[model samples]
Target: MDRTPSFLQQHKQTFQRVGAVLLAILVWQVLAMAVGHQLLVPSPLSVLERLAGIWLEAGFWSTVWFTFRKIVAGFLLGLALGLGLGSLAGRFPLFEILFRPWAVMVKSVPVASFIVICLIWMSSARLSIFISFLMVLPIVYTNVLQSIRSVDRQMLEAVQIFRLPWAKRVLYLWLPQMKPYLISACSVGLGISWKAGIAAEIIGIPSGSIGQMFYDAKVYFNTTDLFTWTIIVVVVSVLFEKGFLALLKWLYGRLEKL
Candidate 1:
């Protein structure tokens, strides 16, 4: 097997990334200075100042918690449903046939349409959960199904021949094979869930949400606030993605040791 990149190489790459980010910020500051108006393009420093102010506010944490809870709930629910359905579809032709049309529709439908329709049927407070679930479900389902299909037939046949219990088969064979796919799906799906959930919140104007803050910023023409809130969203989204994926990898490692 090929060896992983050395620590020195990884550190070099990290420094390069940091350098690139600094260069981009420098360019942004120069442009903002040339514009001579905060409205047009606020300097990076101004946005950072606004970020600091927002960071100190209790409402900021509340909004973060509110959105985080809803998004996580939706993501977990979608993951459970997708895994169950995908497993069934992978195992049985009948289940795959039954779910095919629905999966197709989900993958094809525009998120905006789902949000509008959901708004008519559900409360605004629940809109984020619904939208996030909808956005994540298809991706998880598809990725998991693909993973299932990719499982080694020889290994499966060996398990069958040995008459292993279903649970044993799943724990020993299925899960190990599906690790990469599940991880990939979660990484992509979590980001999608956050984006869709926030978009839904914006449209639904849910009280005390990050999306609502963005909406308020727009209403007041507070571009600095808008940029700051957007920065918060990006930071939170990236952090969540990284944290969740790391957890998943750790769990997989533990499972392998077992």
Candidate 2:
């Protein structure tokens, strides 16, 4: 007989999530009615209708795909560079010293400043990639460096005593120890990448981008379109985050089994 709790069953949490979403939409509708101005706050129904309209447009899909490609490209590049740099910084004091100021600056500087600076240096089409990379780099670097520092000294000593190969030590010990930090870094970095990338696109207004649609909506004062596009961004970002994190979790499971 299956002894699992009912709460742990499939679709239990799904139903709860759907109920919560419906409740939130109802609250939003009530609040919009109370406000009595679509400009100030669009009704949920109006936004949904706008979303449906946009969903039928070929241009909408193109813009979404363009923005998505740039965001993903930037995120991956930043993730790779961050992992490499963090490993170096973690392993060598000199490298850490050299990179510390840059990491600090990246972490502390306002994203708007980065966007403006990048706009002057490159075409609008590439701004999202650069901005997203900039936003994600320090996060991944800091988290990974911390993870490396936090590795157990006893484990290192054991590896040394066994005279294990460097690759073996790194694979079995270092990578396993850093899994939590890597996961945390990825979660934070992915969100930052999307936020900063979209912000860059908005400011730059590149053709064939979600940001351009947002800009056009603002220019025309189309509140419904604006709300609809904003919802699309949120939905896309959430879906990407969920998918990426699930993949990360699966990778960690494989690593653990190894």
Best by TM-score: 1
- State the lDDT of candidate 1 residue by residue for 14-92, as single tens digits: 8899999999999999999999888878889999998878878877798999999999899988999999999989888
Q: Compute each candidate's TM-score over C-alphas.
A: 0.93, 0.92
lDDT tens per residue, model 2, 18-131: 989999999999999999999988999899888778888877788899999999899988988999999999999899999999999998999999999989999999999999
Question: Each prediction's Cα lDDT score?
Answer: 0.90, 0.90
Compared with the true structure, model 1 gives a TM-score of 0.93
How high is the lDDT of residue 148 in model 1? 89
TM-score of 2: 0.92
lDDT for 127 in candidate 2 is 100
